[model samples]
Each structure stands twice: as structure tokens, then as C-alpha cells.
Target: MPDAPAPAPVPLDRSAFAADAVTVAQALIGTTLLVDGVGGVVVETEAYDCEDPASHAFNGPTPRNAPMFGPIGHAYVYRSYGLHWCLNLVCDASQLGSAVLIRAIAPTEGIAIMRDRRGLEALRLLCAGPGRLAQALAVTGAMTGLPLDAPPFRLLPRTEAEPAIAVGPRIGLTRGVATPWRFGLAGSPFLSKPFR
Candidate 1:
């Protein structure tokens, strides 16, 4: 694909983003995701459906997961290992507690600051992992429950290059490993390490 104009807002209405979990994951890739005071990063994410009991919000809304219960395109940041922060994009309007986990990102700009913030030496490793991407982009509990279109974080227009998608098991989830909810750029080295 040659250089082209940026895509218009992907109509992130309540219904658009509130689709099945896997669909949300595939749709996020190539979509520009921005972080305020930091910068933007293109999304490369994986979905975890609510049907899967292993999902964090599968049990329903709580203080930590309340953001997922909101309308589509909201940020849901959670703490992991009592240290790192992982970001989830809200979806499934009616269910009110479903989200797609942002497994990774391809840093589009601000590479210098992002690398420093993440303490990473290599560019590929900057946003290679879920927690690393969030930390590098300044995602935290404070950014949770925020709208994607507003400030702090934004999902910019999708680029012209459409990545071929491949689906597989969601990482870290043993119960639904066979569900094929994970989506990534086919043949792209940046795709998450295939679940073993």
C-alpha cells in the first residue's frame, strides 16, 4: 500500500467497539493509539471474551474492572505482578464488562522518550509485551476509565497498510487457549510469541 490519507474516526460508537471480544482484538491492530503527555503507538492487541471464565472481567464489574463496564473505546488499566500495568480496551456495551487486552504496540513516534521510559535498549522490545507497552506509553490506573477519543489516550485513524490477521489462543489463559481469540499481523515478527 502506498502512502495515503489517515482513516476517519472508526466510528467508535458504543455499539462499534462493543462487539465480540475477538473482533475487537483484530480491529485494533493498525489503529493509532495515542497517550497524552507521552505519545501515540499503533495497537497490536488480543481479545479475551467474557465467555471465557479466565478473563479478568468475566466475573463482572468491580472497582478495578469498572472501566470495562462502560461504553466502548474506554481504557481499562490494571496492575499485574503487583508491579506492571496492562491496558485493556473496553467493548461489549450490554455486557458492560468485556474488553480486549492490548498485548503489544508498534511505536509509531516518540521512540526516544518511549524507550527511555521503558528502559529498553532495542526498538523491537520497547512495546513488544503488554506491560512494557503500557509502561512505555504512560498507561496506568489513572488512565483507566478514560475515553479513547478524549485526552490522555487516543485511538487515531487507521493507517493505509492493512496487516493480514492471524488468530490463535490468548496468551496466559489456559481455559480458553483453543478459542482462537488472539489476532496478530501474519508473519510479522512483532506478533506476540505464539502461546506454547
Candidate 2:
């Protein structure tokens, strides 16, 4: 018998991101996120909102965080520690400057491209953190404000039922150390860090 065909990639509607960052972050687990056909399944995420002291938008819109204040379902790319590029998806349809940081992904597609971009052969290290994920997918500050539903970005809904999830305080934040906004796929080796 012939091999079974893969199911079509379902386009996740923008309406799915029309919620708060926390909601979107958790819901994004297990979803496949591709950038120009190079990416993988989302395994980890962190939520940020205007009211959170650790959030870039806590002090309101600035030149760097303008995308977070714009319409929902857009990309909010930023640099971390003046080195790595981090990717976030604007949420909060009310325009309150909320976004879900794509912390980590399990590389599934375009492995060769990601390996070349990252200069590594280890699959687990390819997209295990926001910086690494962005680099592997070629996400940069220039991608900010781009509609996630359009080309160069393809978000496919999880075909299987909801996967097990693990939640904990976000990492690398001094202010909101106990916000418990980080979410990841339970027991997934692709997480940036083990959930505590």
C-alpha cells in the first residue's frame, strides 16, 4: 500500500489571537509556525502585557514597541541584550499592548535551512530558545508589524487534540519573576528551559 498523505495545513485565523497574551501563549503550544517555509512546532512561549512591569509596553508605546500597540495578529520583533532577535505575536484585540513571545520551537520543516542559518547540526538546539528560533527562521526586527497570517509567516493549528502543557514563571525577568506566564509543551525536550 502507498503511504498516507499528510493533512493540509490549516491557517490559524487572526481571531484566535484576539485575546490576551496569556491566553494566546498557552493556546499556541503545539501549533506549527513557519517563516518563509522554515520553522517548526511551537514548544514554549511567554506572555507579556502593558500592565506587566517586565513588559516593554508597560510604559506605553515607543518606537521599538510600536507593533505591540498596533493591531493584533501582527509580528512584534525586538532585540534582546542588543544581540539576539526575539519574536512575539501581538495580541489583545483591545489594543492594550499585549504579546506572546515565541520562546521555543521543535524544528520540523526546513531543517537544512535552519542548520545553515544557525551553523549547527543538532536538531534540539536549532530552535530551543527565542533567539535561536528567530535566527533559525530568519525572523528579525524588520519583520515587526507584518501580519502573521500572510506570506513569510504561516501558523498552522494543531491537528491533534490539545497537548499536555506545563506552566511556570517566565525566565530572565527581574520584575515579574513570579508572574507565571511561561507555558510549554509538557515533557518536550525542545523547551528553552525545563518548566519548574
Candidate 3:
């Protein structure tokens, strides 16, 4: 039999990300994140609000965090630990300074490219962290503030049948640890860190 036809790509609009960070974070699970011709299923994310101390916007919008303060459906790529670039999706209304950190994704496209970028053969290790996910998809600071509706970035809508979701506090945070903003696909081995 011929190979199955690929599923139609669904580009999400800005309205889909207009909700609060936490809500958008949970809703992002299982959605397809396409960047630079690479695709993956979002499996882990962490939400940060303007008021959260762990949030980059907690100290107000700096030059590095301008994207997080802009309209929804934009990308917020930032360098974490002065090293690898991490990808975040701007959420909430304009000036809300809310975003969801995309921590992990299950590689579904461009596996060979991702393997070369990550230097790892294990499927689950391909995009198992914020930095790794960005690197695997070739995301950089240059892509920050770009609208998701355009090329180099497109978020496919989630399926109607909800996957089992696991929620807990955000990771590696010194403050706002009580906020259960982290969301992941339950039992997914692709998770970056163990769910608390």
C-alpha cells in the first residue's frame, strides 16, 4: 500500500494563545510544534505569569523579554544559563508578559536532522529539554518575536481526544514553586524532568 497521506497542517491563530499562561501551557500538550520544517508533538511545558517571581517578566519587560510582553502567538527565544537557547511562546493579552516554556517534544519530523543536531540516538533524548528542543528544531534568538502563524514557526491545534495530562509545579524555580503550572503528557518518557 502507498504511504498514508500526511495529516493536514493546522495553523493556530493568535486567539488560541490569548488565554492565561497556565491555561495555554496545559492546552499546548499534544499539539504539533513545527519550526524550520521540523515537527514534534509538544510533551512538556511550564507556564510563567507576569506576577510570578520565576518569570522573566517579573522584573518588568527588559530588552531580552520584550517578546513576552507583546501580543499572543509570538515566539520568545532566550538564552538560558548563558548558554543554550530556550523557546517560549508568548501567551495572554498584549502587555500581560505571560509565556509558556516549551520544555520537551516528541520528535515526529526531521528525525535525522534532530539526531545530527543533538548527537543522540535515543528517540526520547532528542528534544527532552527546553534547550535541547530549541537546538533540535534550529530555533535561535533570531526567531524570537516572530508570529507563530508565519513560516519557521507554526503550532498545530491539539486533537479532540485529550491525552492524559500531568500537572505540577514549575521546574528549577526558586520562587513560585507552589504554582502548579508545569504540564506534561502523562507517562511520556520524553519528559525533561520527573513530574513532581
Candidate 4:
């Protein structure tokens, strides 16, 4: 017998990101994210709101974080530790400064491209962290403020039933350490770290 065909990717409506960051984060699990058709399934994410001290938007908009204060359904790409790019999906209404940080993904498409960009053969390490995920997908500061539904980016809706989600405090955060805003696909080996 032949193997079953994978379901066609469903385009996620931009309106789907109009909710708060936490809501969007939890909903992002299992969805597919592609950058010029090179990406994979979202396995982990963290929510950030303007009120959260650990969030870049906590102190209000700046030249760099202005996109977080912009409209929803846009990218908020930024550099972390001045070393690597991290990708965030702006959510909520304009000026709300809420976004979901894409932490990890299970590579399902464009594996070769991800491997070349990451310079690693380990599939698990390709997109298992925000910085690595951004690199694997070729996300950069230039992508910031761009509409997620537009070219070079394609966020597909989850075609299957929602997977079980695990909740935990966000990683590398001193403030809001106990907020439990991090969400991930329960039992997914692709997560950056195991959720406790």
C-alpha cells in the first residue's frame, strides 16, 4: 500500500492573530511556518505583552521594537544578544505591543535549506530555539513589520486536531519568571527544552 498524502496547507487568516499574545501563542502550536517555502511545524512559543517587564515592548515602543506596537499579523524580527535574529509575530490591536515569540519548530519542509543555513546535520537543532529558528528560516531584521501573509512568509493553519499543549515559564527571563506564558506541543521532541 502507498503512504497517505499530507493535507494541503491552509492559509491562516490575518484576523486569527488579532487576539492577545498568550492566546495566539497557544493557538500557534502545530501550525506550519514557511519562509519562501522553507520551514516547518511550530512546536514551541512564548507570549509577551507590553505589561510584561521581560518583553521588549514593556517600556513602550522604540526604533527597534516599533513593530510590536504596530498592527497585528506582522513580523517583529530582532537580534538577540547582538548575535542572532529572533522572530516574533505581532498580535492584538495596533499599539498593544503584544507578540508571540516562535521558539522552536519541527522541520518538515526545506530540510536541505535549513541544514545549509544552520551548518548542521542534526535536524533537532536546526529550529529548536528562537535564534536557530530564525536562522534556519532566514528571518532577519528586514522581515520586521512585514505582513506575515505576504511573500517570503507563509503561516499555514493547523490542518489536524489541536495537539496537547504544555505550559511553563518562559526561558531566559528574569522578570515574569513564573508567568507560565510559554506554550509548546506536549511531548514534542522538537521543543527547545522540555516543559516542566
The Cα RMSD of model 3 versus the native structure comes to 2.3
- Per-residue CA lDDT of model 2 for 105-176, tens digit only, reads 999999999999999999999999999999999998889999999989999998668899999999998899
lDDT of 4 by residue, 23-64 (tens): 999999989999999999999999999999999999988999
Whose lDDT is greatest here?
2
**Over all chains combined, what TM-score does candidate 4 have?**
0.94
Per-residue lDDT tens digits of candidate 3, residues 123-168? 9899999988988999999999999888988788887468899999
**How do the predictions measure up, each by TM-score?**
0.85, 0.96, 0.93, 0.94
Estimate the lDDT of model 2.
Answer: 0.93
Clashing pairs in 2: none
lDDT of 4: 0.93
Model 2: lowest-lDDT 10 consecutive positions: 7-16
Write down the worst ten-residue block by lDDT for model 4.
Answer: 6-15
lDDT of 2 at 25: 97
Clashing pairs in model 4?
A: none
For model 4, the stretches where C-alpha displacement exceeds 4 angstroms are 1-7
| Per-residue error (Å), model 1, residue 24 | 1.6
- Model 1 stretches astray by more than 4 angstroms: 1-15, 37-43, 194-196
Write candidate 1's Cα lDDT for 1-196 as tens digits: 7889855665344455867777778777776776864544444577765667768777876887778777787888899878889988888775666788887777767888898897877877888778888878888888888887677666654565566777777777667667777776666555547433
Say which prediction, candidate 2 or candidate 4, comes out ahead on TM-score: 2
